[model samples]
Target: MDNYKFILSGGGTGGHIYPAIAIANELKKRYPNAEFLFVGAKDRMEMEKVPEAGYKIEGLWITGLQRKLTLKNLMFPFKLISSLLRARKIVSQFKPNAVIGTGGFASGPLLKIASGRKVPCLLQEQNSYAGVTNKLLKDAVAKICVAYDGMEKFFPAHKIVKTGNPVREDLIALTGNKKEALSFFELQENKQTLVVLGGSLGARRINKLIEKKIGFFKEAGLQIIWQCGKLYFEEYKKYNSDTVKVMAFINKMNYAYASADVIISRAGAGSVSELSIVGKPVVFIPSPNVAEDHQTKNAMALVNNNAAILVKEKDLDADFDTVFSGLIASKEKQEEISKNIKNMALPNATKDIVDQIEILLKK
Candidate 1:
């Protein structure tokens, strides 16, 4: 029992993969003798990211079905069947103590197979709206760790544990002072800093909005830290100046979060969780392109609680100037929001999740 083996399956994006990695890391801390293995779709981000996180991962021959009719859509049945067979083989060979899934198509077959083999299964649903894989596997998993309220609409009340989402360890405790953070980014200490994040690929609409508002920000005497993503770096790089630091990515996010007077971000589950912990006043422009518009739902959960402000893509032109300007002008509003958002953060999320896994192991 001391040498417990756990299999974690989730991928396609960082939202899914990072949570799995975080949970695995926590499990490693609690049970140093435990064995951890990750299962993800072949050729997906998880294949590379999992190894980078120092864990072994196996790839399943699987991918999500496309909305429009295409060759990949037509091949869905073959892929699902192949993935299921391979997953069953993995379950049989590894004989995991428990299977943990973080909700992506890659997790579906693996969790299903592991549960069928009578292995204890747990799922971590990061978003307010459950993913298709998690929903389908809900009946199979012994417990479901969720981030938002009203998830009983998607999951069984008895199985659900409101543990929030696992965030990067570095973000949990921001040890750097604002002075240190500002120096790290080479920004002026006297100027208020506006940090913009649009995920790893760069959001087109967000990039455009930031570009359009550059003049307004400069007039307001705000320094900016813009992470425009790798895809849009070249096009936005010309705008970089002494006051505006534009980059493909920020390796030191703790510094960025510490240095921010305010934050403008996309409402990904991971980002929301991190921002809540960062406790900064934020404006969330949820991406409308995601499945079921879950990003909007994620943002609304905070907005409804007065923890953050949300401006939809369509309403940006009319609302952005007024909303952002008002928030910036009032330190009272900023403090109120910062306090509310920090209250919503579950700083012990990763540990809480591992506690559930320990319960399964004890059983």
Candidate 2:
């Protein structure tokens, strides 16, 4: 009679979608017979990603409220009402023992309705700075799972659990094999390697800076592993040479993290969490395009602690050359950054989050 049902909701970007899937996967591992359903925004990335993760998903006609004046903002009320009704229906039909939301556009409505119906809901907040949606639903959520410290500024202090983020299991597995990783990338055992990632979609500023500074990397004699993302792949692929490996998507992220002597990346919450676990010297370039500038706050949490370096997007073009070159040339600085950031790793976050769910479900 194992009929424990769980509904997991999150979407809009890989940042939100992946964490929800990681939690769902953890639940599956612990409760093999549990039925799981995902709720995400219609026409969003989650519609495709959730199915790919081997779960059933229902989409709501939900969108984020516009920040600027537009016709879309005029339709906001109708979409909100429709989505709330749809979410309530899904919650009633699923009859979930417990529901989980990783913050996103769909999560606000889905968790709100589930909480209104007396279903226990868990909110996973990934950033150091909480988003408006998560902040609005904080009181309605049964418990809050967070990656950063001092989130009491946003959530009820008693309900907060510092469970770090649940990253891809593969990235955690990278901790063991450094030598195997260098060989896998066909990198020389002794040379310093630098890994540059602009996320899966790529950051325009980071890509442009790297594209224009190829000779600097060559002059420094540093080996490069660049993940330029899908958007700028074609334009940047020509920069690939014997010393530099360029890719649109890196299927084997564990190898990339393990092989790197240093990493330059955008400071998305997920990337920050994974980088912390990988324990590499990292330079963060937080994207200016994100809502509330949460990415900068996410990186600053670490930078303030001397765990990593930050290069503002606008400053990357002018300042990155000297800063990057100096860091790569200093082994002491690299080791110090690596050791400091590794202190932030939460390797057991998946287990902790699942444990929280189990505790709430049993109650």
Candidate 3:
């Protein structure tokens, strides 16, 4: 078991990729000599991120199918065939004791082939709504590790384990202090700080909403730390001032979480898991563009518990001002939301996930 070899596959976004990486890190901790090979789609963020996290990764020629007819859609069959062949080759050669998939386009072919070859497989589904890839591979995987309740609607009840999403280690415990965090972001200690996160690529609607609300935020006696994402940084950086900090990305999220009085964020599963652990009052703006509108479902899971607030995209113009103002004005509301959200945090999620993987490997 000490020399166990494992293949981890999941990618396309930070939501899927980070959970896979977190699981691998935990497995590495348990078995120091274990070998891990990550498989992801070519040119996806995981190709860069997995290696940066100190793991060897291979990329398959694959991409998700488009909704409308297009050249890429026509190429889907060929890409899937090529990816399956490559995945089979990897599995046969690596002979992994267990294959873990976190759910993405890349994981479909890899997990399909590994499970077909009789290798034990486990899946981690991060969203409240299951991804297409996870659902397709549900029967093939021995166990499905899920973060939210009611996943049996998408996955088999017997195959499901209610282990929350694995968050990045840095976010699990913010070691930085408020004073240093304030200094790091160059914000005034007297002003209440609001942090805006639009995921890695930024959200167009959210960015526009923030742009229009700058004066509103200033009037509310709040300072801002806005992560506009790399694609939109240049367009929004002009708004940066002493009270409003703007950046393409945040390298030190621990400090950002530490300095925040309130947070406005996209409802990605990874963000939800991290925010729960951070235990801050948050307002979620779920992106409507994703498959199955999973973001909305992810937000509703917390909003139902009164652990967070949700302002839909269509209602942002009308609801955001009133909702934000009401929340900010009430210290009692903030503390109540913060405490409730913290109650939902699964601090030992990574460890719990790895324990399931161990069961599969032993079988």
Alpha-carbon lDDT, every model:
0.95, 0.90, 0.94
TM-score of 1: 0.99
Question: What number of backbone clashes does candidate 2 have, counting pairs of residues 3 or more apart or in separate chains?
Answer: 0
- Can you write out model 2's per-residue Cα lDDT over 156-261, one digit (the tens) per residue? 9999999999999987877647689878777787778889999888888888888788888878888888999999999999988778899998888888887888
| Cα deviation of 113, candidate 3, in Å | 1.5
lDDT of 1 by residue, 6-111 (tens): 9999999999999999999888888889998899999999999999999999999999989999999999999999999999999999999999999889999999
> In model 2, how large is the Cα lDDT of residue 42?
93
Which RMSD values do the candidates have, in order?
A: 0.8, 1.3, 1.2
> Which has the higher TM-score value, candidate number 1 or candidate number 2?
1
List clashing residue pairs in candidate 2: none
Worst 10 residues of 3 by lDDT: 167-176
Note the residue pairs that clash in candidate 1: none
Off by over 4 Å in 1: none
Q: Which of the numbered candidates is closest to the native, going by highest lDDT?
A: 1
Q: Residue 346 deviation, candidate 2, in Å? A: 0.9
